[model samples]
Every structure is written in structure tokens, then in C-alpha cells.
Target: MADLPRILVITDRTQVRTTVENVVRAVCKEAGCTWVLLRDRDLPPLERRRMAQRLREVTNECKAKLSISSDAQLAADVGAEGVHLQRVSDIDGVRALLPKGWIGVSAHSVAEVRLAKEEGADYVTLSPIFPTESKPGYGPPLGLETIREASAIGIPIFALGGITPRSGFSCVEAGAYGFAVMGTVMRASSPGKVIRDYAAAFATSSSRA
Candidate 1:
């Protein structure tokens, strides 16, 4: 529930142009990404844990926060800054598992956002504000209205999906706390630039608000 950075870089193994670890290293080296989530859901637990360990080192070297998606045990084992939940059913159980960890969850609808708030999610990412290549077939784009609606519910709502510096400010204006992105950062030749651009936009928009 502490102040999370305005820019969050979500790492997906399947979406990277190069190796996942290399992408993380390059992005962090660029110096704009404040938090990075290791979110490869298909990898076996051992492999995921290994990748998380490597990412933790990268985050440490860059003085950035690192989190593992959907694996509280591994997050605790790796001493991550936090754990994000995608499919966890019981927040109470997760809270017990991660007593001191920062928590975030994915919310698709306003109802889900309220549920997440009740369940004690520190933040929630409301997705598909625009069409996103990283996540296809999940559903149609939720649009900026989802962010606007969720913002009224009180949890810090992060807009995810097809976010860019130009479009990011629209999300902030619509009342999102920040942005979470994957494909844009993953496929970028200069991920640092992308992050810096988005961060700048967020700062300017937040100031105006």
C-alpha cells in the first residue's frame, strides 16, 4: 500500500524479443523502470523460481523493486519486494502467506475492483484500456472507462494494455493511478526510452491533477 512507482514494467517470457533475463537487464540498465514483475505463467515452478532469482539480482543491482506473479512462496523465498496475484482465489490465504509483502491484483470489472479492495489488494491493474498484443483473446478491450469506473472504488487502479506515453496521460486524466505495460517494453529496441517517456507523461498529468 506504499506509494508504488508511476511506471511498472511487466515482464513476460513469451513476449520478449530476446531472452527474458536479458530484456530485464537491458530495461533496468536504462534506468526508468521502477518496478518489474516476472510474469511467465507457463514456466514450471522450478524454472520460474530460477528466473525470479535472476530478476531479483537485476532489480537489486538497479535499485528497483522486483515481484513474482502468482507465487507467494517463491516471492518469499526470493525475498521479493512484493507478489502480484492473477488467479489466486483467497486473499486471506495470500495475506497469511505474505504478511509483510506489498500486494496487487488484476481486476476486470468494477465489481472485481470492489472485490479486490475488500480483499485488501494494495493496488489493482485494470486491463485492456487499449488493444494489446501481449494479451490477446482475454476479451475485447475494456477501454478507458474501466479505469475511470474503477478509480471511484478507492483502490489504486493501474491501467494496463497498449499504453504509450501519448495515451498514458489519458489514463491518468481518467483517474488511473498509473500504468502497467508489457509488450511495449518487451519488444522495444530502447525500453528505457519507452519507460522514461511514459514516466514523464505520468508526472505531468499527475501534477495537473
Candidate 2:
């Protein structure tokens, strides 16, 4: 939408006390939440499609972009805005399939960030900037400098993992284009407050944030 969204809510039903649909609808009531990645990796195609359809409507109502994780064809079929690819995913193939929408990738380091940039990813989620309980095995946190280094790849880089409203500024200081998170919005009891906090942090440091 603006090259990329400033704040993205990564969805996971297991991580939240509420349903994914409810969480998306709740946090996206404001303009701060510009993106949602529907990441239910365990559901069957039909069930996931139905869920995506429900989320798609909510995103539309809020004027936010909705993307499904790791499924280009399914994303297209479900009327999502685009697809977010895995680290080892075939970008060229997915790009061919999704010739008309946003295509983002997961990256863990500077090399992968460069790869995504070189291979033409619309944006990349450079993750585990902090040790996160949700991603115990994604390697140790990369810290702020790694984020600064990765941002040189010339693609929009979103800092992921253990991102709270308090920590979002560190990402901006480290040169993150924005931040992507799950629990900050999903598990939040006061999701609107957290969302606004994130927006404020991003905005204070960025013109578009």
C-alpha cells in the first residue's frame, strides 16, 4: 500500500486467547494496523480458505491489507492482498504465480536479506531481533546492529520477534522500516492501546510510520 505497511500483525490462533478473526477486527479498528498475515499453518485447505475469507472481509472493512502465509495460490483463491513466503521458499515460482500482488519473504540474516532484495521481494521480515517465546528455535536474537546491517539490502525490512510497544523504538533506531509481531496484538488484553503505541513509536521516528 505504501511500499509496505508500517505495522503488521502476524496471526496465530494458538498464541491468543481470542480467535484470529476477533483479533484482526479489534486491532485494525485504527489505521496503525496496516497489515495482517493469516498464518494458520495447521488447517486444511477448505477450512483455511473459509477462515481467510472471514479475515479478508474484516481487513477490507478496516482498510488494511490481508496476506496469507506461504500459499500463493490459496492467497489468490481466498482474495487476500498477497502471500508471505518462507525462508527456503522458491520466490521465482511464487512470483510467477502471483504476478499481480505483493510478495514478501522471511529472512534471518544479512545474506538472506540481500537474497530477498536481489530476488525482488516486496519486503522482508528480518526476525528474532529479540529472544521470543513464540519462536524458540529461530536462533538467538540478532540485536540492533544486525538490523542496521540488514536494512542496507535496499528492501523494506520489518523487525520481528519479542516486539512490544516499549521495544519498537529500538527497531526504528536499528534502521527497521517497521515492525511485525504476533503476541503484541494477538495476546494483548488491550490491543487498541498496544496498536496505538506501536503506531506512535513508528511515527515519532518515521514520516510514514
Candidate 3:
């Protein structure tokens, strides 16, 4: 596996007024984002595939990797770099589909993170680290302590949920390998600037470490 990106951009089409491709391109080109996870799973299969294809083209031009969210077959069909699984049940299935590609999962606890690692997932987004509108129904926030424990399990943990440029450094101090963002970037008026801020945060964190 290549060195994972310090910031993972999760897409939510509903949060943005413009097209996802434009946002992704801006972030990739300006913010220097190297990875994007396409998460518009509510779309019809054909539409999702088409969007994935378009995103793949856009990401390619920006020298970034595109990973389909929770759809291994579609990811394979589109030649994506990987797939981000929503549940552990899909790990084994996805492995067979993208043998050499990255496989990540969404985990909410230490046990779940352990399970993902044991199942051969390359990494995980341990989410809800802070209260956020993005996933309000995901129960209470897991908090930074969860990242402290989950990172010890040996998987590269990306702290998700309510992570912003200001709060992202705290996650790194707590032992997160990286952090993921959805609404923050997707809903930003200047998505590229947001990405640039995240990159700066990570750089500062790395230096202090």
C-alpha cells in the first residue's frame, strides 16, 4: 500500500450546491488532496457508476485516487483504487474484488476497529469524534479517547465526524494517523481553502510529533 493521504475527503452530494466533480477537482488541485471517497450511494446504480466514472476522470487529471464508498463491484468496474466498506460483512467480499487495492472500513469503537484490522482492512475511519450534523443519528460522539485506543490496534485510523482544520490536530495528538471530513469540505464556500487548511494542520501536527 502507498502512503495513505493525511486527509480523506468524503463526498455528500446533497451538501453541496455544485457538482461533485468540480468540488473534487478543486480540492485535489488546490488543497492537494490525494484521495477521495465517493459516498453518494442513494443514486441509482447506473447514475452512481456514471458519476464514479466522471470522478475517476477528474481525479486522474489531478493525480489523485478515487475509492467507491461501499460498492466493491462498481469500484472494480470503474477501476477505482479501492473501496471503503460501511460494514465488516463486506470486507472479505471486497478483498476478492480488489486484491491489490486499498480497503477501509467505518468503525465506531475499539472493538470494531480491531475487527476491521483482523479482517485485513488496510485502514478505518473511526467516526463521530465530535458532535456534528453530518451523522447526527450515529448516537453520541465517540470522542478523542476512542482514537487513542483504536490506533493502538495497529490499523491506520482516520478520525471522522465533525473534524475541522482547528480540531484536526487534536486527533493527531491522540494518535490518529489521519482524519476524514464530509460536510466541512463539501459544504464549504471555498472547498480548496478548506483542504489547504487541513494540509497545514497535518503538517503542523507532523512537525510537532
Most accurate candidate by TM-score: 3
2 against 3, candidate with superior TM-score = 3
Q: 1-209, model 3: which lDDT tens digit per residue?
A: 34888789989999986989889999999878999999998999999999999999999999999899989999999899999998988888888899988999989889999999889899999988999998888868999889999989998999999898989989999999989999999998899999898877778987986
Model 2 C-alpha lDDT per residue in residues 1-209, reported as the tens digit of each score: 36677888888888777788888888888434778999988999888888899999999988888898998888888777778998645778877777877888998898999988888888999989998878889898998999999987778889999888888988997889899989767888877778888888866777654
Descending-TM-score candidate ranking: 3, 1, 2
In model 2, pairs of residues that clash are: none
For every candidate structure, what is the RMSD over all alpha carbons to the true structure, in angstroms?
Answer: 1.5, 2.1, 1.0
After superposition, the stretches of candidate 1 with alpha carbons farther than 4 Å from their true spots are none
Query: For each candidate, what TM-score against the reference?
Result: 0.94, 0.93, 0.97
Relative to the true structure, how large is the alpha-carbon lDDT of every model?
0.83, 0.84, 0.90
| TM-score between model 2 and native | 0.93
Residues 1-209 of candidate 1 have per-residue lDDT tens digits of: 44788778888777677777777777778755768888887898888888888999888988888877888888889989788897537567777877877788988888888988987888888887888777777778888888888899998898998888899999999999888988988888777777778888767885886
Instruction: List the pairs of residues colliding in candidate 1.
Output: none
Off by more than 4 A, model 3:
none
